[model samples]
Target chain A: MTIYENKYRITYEAFSKFSAKLSKANDKAELLEIVQKHLKYFFNFKYFRVLLKDEVFLKSFHVFHNSNNSPEFILNEFFSYEEDLLKNHIPIQHSSNGEFLNNYDQKLNLNNGKLWAWYFKYQDLQLCVSLISDDEKPFIVRDIEILNLLIDSFVTKYQQIKLKNRLHQKNVNLKNAINVIEEQKFQISKIVYNQKNTIEQRTKKLKDQNSKLAEISRLNAHNVREPLSRILGLLEIAELYEEKDLKKEIFEKIKTSAKDLDHILQDIIYKSNNAIEKLSSKTPPTK
Target chain B: MMPDKIKIFLVDDQKIANFITQKLLQTSNIDCEVLAFDQPIQALDAVEKDLPNFIFLDLNMPKLNGWQFLEQMQKNITSKVIILTSSSDPADVEKAKDFPQVISYQTKPPSREILQELILG
Candidate 1:
C-alpha cells in the first residue's frame, strides 16, 4: 500500500475505535477522558486541553488536559479570550512569536510554541479545545479536518449525556409532585373524619335533651292534671250540696288540690331552668 | 231496663279521691251499693270474691295500676269497667280501648249528668 493510503487507513481505524469508546462513556467526565486519549494518539502535541461548560449549571465546567511533561496551563488565565471566541464560533491561531502569547502569564511555556484554539456551541453547551505544539512544522489543512471530525463526535456524546441528565431531573420533579398531592389528599380525609365524629356526638347530646323534655311533658300531663282534676271535682260537688257544713268541707278540699297543682308548676319551672343553665354553661370544642 | 240496687266498685290510690267520689255518689241518691277502696290490690281481692256489676278504675297507683287490675279482673269477671283518670292525655284514653272489659274512659270530676247516664244506660 502507498504511504498516503496507509496513513488514511490508520486514521480511519483510530476514528472507529475512538467512536466505540465514546459511545460507551456514561457521563461528561468519562467522555472527556476518552476524547483526551484519542486526541493525544491522533495528534502528538506539546500541550492539549479541553474545556466544556455544563448545559444545566452554567458556571460549572469539565476540563481535560494532556499531562505528559507539559507545563501547567491554568484555565483562569485564558478566561479573557472566551467572550470573543464564543460569539464568533471561529478558531484562533498563534505562531511561535505572535503578540497573542503576551496575553498569558509568563510562567506558562506557550512563549515558544504554535497555538490553535476553537470555541463552538454543541447542543446547549459551549465547548473549547486548544492545541499547542513546539515543533517547526505549522498545522496543515488535513490536521484541522481531523480535529473537526473528532470534535463532532465529542459534541454528539456530550448532547446524549446532557439529555439523559435533564430527563432524570424531570422524573425526580414529577415524583415529588405526586407525593405532595397524596399528602394533601390524606389531610383532607382526616379532616372529614373528624367532622363526622363531631356531628355524631352532637346528635347524641340532642337526643338526650329531647328525651328529658319528653319526660317533663309527661309529668305535666299526669302529675299536674291529678291535682287540677280534684279541684274541679270538689267545685262540682259543692254546687250540688245544700248544707253550709258540706260546702265548707268541699272548699277545704279545693284549696288543697290548688296548692298541689301550684307545687307541680313550680317543679316543672325549676327543672326547665336547670336544663337551660346546663346547656348555656357548656362551651363548644375547638378544631 | 236499668237494674235496681246496682253493685259498684270504686278503686283509687288517693284516700281523698275515694272519699270525695263516695260522697258524690251518696249525695246523688243513686240506688247502688258503692264499695270504695284506696288500694287497688284490696279492690282486686274484693272483686275476686264478689264481682261488682260496675267498676270505676283510676289509672295511676303505687302497687298495681288500673291496666294491671283490669288484666287480672278480665280473667274471671264479665263486669263493665269505666276508666276514671286525672290524666286527660290522648295516649291514656287510647290505651283504654285495648281492654275488652272497659266500657268507657272519663277524665276526673265526671259530671252528675254523665254518671246518671252511665247508671241509666
Candidate 2:
C-alpha cells in the first residue's frame, strides 16, 4: 500500500471504534460519557457543544476538554454563536478568544481560543454544532467527516429515547379515554333501569283505578237501581187493578221499595264523604 | 197445541227482582206458567231439563255471571233470552249483541210494553 492509503486506513479504524462505542450507549448519561472518552481520537477541540431541537423541545449539550471535565445538558438555553449558525445555516468562525469561544478559565487550562460553528439538519432534527480550539490543539478541516458520523450516532440515540417516551404517553391517554366511555355506559344503563321501575309503578296504579271504577259501577247498577225500577213497575201495574186491590197488593210493595232506595242512598253518601276526607288528608296520593 | 201454556223462566240473582217480574206478568193478565229462580245454578238445571219458551236473565250475579251462563248454554240453547238488568249502562246492551240466543235487551223492572213485545209479539 502507498503511505497515503495507510494513513487513511488508520483514521477509518479510529472512527469505527468510536462509532461502535457510541452505538452501545444505552442512555443520555452513558452516551455523553462515551462521547467524552472517544471524541479526542477523531478531532482535537478545547470545547464542544451541540444545540439540538425538534418540534417540542430545544436542548444544548456541552463538553469541556480541560482534563477535569463533564458534559453539560441544558434545556432551552443557547449561545449567540449557535443562534447565528441556526438562522444563517452557515459555518462561522471567531479567530481568537472572541465572545463566540468557550469561557472555561482555570490554572490548568492554558490555551487561547478560536471558535468554529456549523448548522445542519437530519430528518426532523435541527443541529447547531460548535467547537473551540487554540493554536496548540487545532480543529482541522480533514476531521469534519469523522465528527459528522459521531453526531449521526448521537442524534439517532436521542430520537429513539424520545419516540419511546411518546409511545408510553399515548398508551396512558388511551387507557383514560376507555375508562371514561365505560363510566358513561354504566350511567346510561342505570337511568334506563330507573325508568323501567317507574313504568311498572304507573301500571300498578292504573290497574288499581280500573278495579275501583268497576266496583262503583256494579254497586250503582244492581243495588241503587233495582228497587227504584221495581217501584216504577209496581206503580205502572196498579192501573190494571182496583184501588182497593192495590191498597192490599201494590201499596205495601211500594213502601218496601222506597225504604230500600232510601237506605242505599244513605249508604252511598256516607262512603263518598269518607273517601273525600281520605283524599284531602294526603298531598301526593299513595298507590 | 198447548200454545196458551207458555213456559216462561225468570232468572235473576235477586229474589225480589224475580218476584217483581212474575207479579207484573200476572197483573198484565198474561196466560203463561211462570217459573222464577234467584239462584242461577238452579235456573240452569231447570232450563236444561225443560227448555223455556222465553228466558229472562240478569247480567250480574255471584259465582256465575250472565256471560258465563250463556257460554255454558251455548251448546244447544234454542230458547230466546231477554236481558233483564237494572243497569242503565249501554255497555251491557252493546255486549248482549254477541249472543244470538239473546233476542232482546231490557232494563228492569221491564216496562209492560217490553214484555208484550217479547212474549206476545
Best by TM-score: 1
Model 2 lDDT per residue over B1-121, tens place: 6655878999887766787788777766678889998888998989999898899998888888888888888789698899888886767788899999999989887876678778888
Instruction: Tell me each candidate's TM-score.
Output: 0.76, 0.60
lDDT of 2 by residue, A1-287 (tens): 98746755876788788777766766677777788877777778877888988787889887777654667578998887778777889898776564543344532243666788888898889999988888778887867877777888778877776676778789899889889989999999999999999999989886897789688867755688888987887777777778778787888888888999999989888988887787688668679
* Per-model i-RMS: 1.2, 1.8
For A179-234, candidate 1 gives per-residue lDDT tens digits of: 99899999999999999999999899889879978977886779988988888788
Please give the DockQ score of every candidate, comma-separated. Answer: 0.58, 0.43
Poorest lDDT segment (10 consecutive residues) of candidate 1 chain B:
B14-23
Which 10 consecutive residues of model 2 chain B have the lowest summed lDDT?
Answer: B23-32
After superposing candidate 2 on the true structure, give the runs of residues whose Cα lies further than 4 Å from its correct spot: A1-43, A51-60, A63-137, A140-175, A211-223, A241-248, A251-255, A262-287, B1-4, B13-16, B27-29, B38-52, B62-80, B88-103
Best by DockQ: 1
Q: What does candidate 1's lDDT look like per residue over B61-109, in tens digits?
A: 9889998998888887978899988987788888889998899898887
Point to the candidate with the largest lDDT.
2
Q: Rate the local accuracy (lDDT) of all candidates.
A: 0.74, 0.80
- What's the distance in Å from true for residue A149, model 2? 11
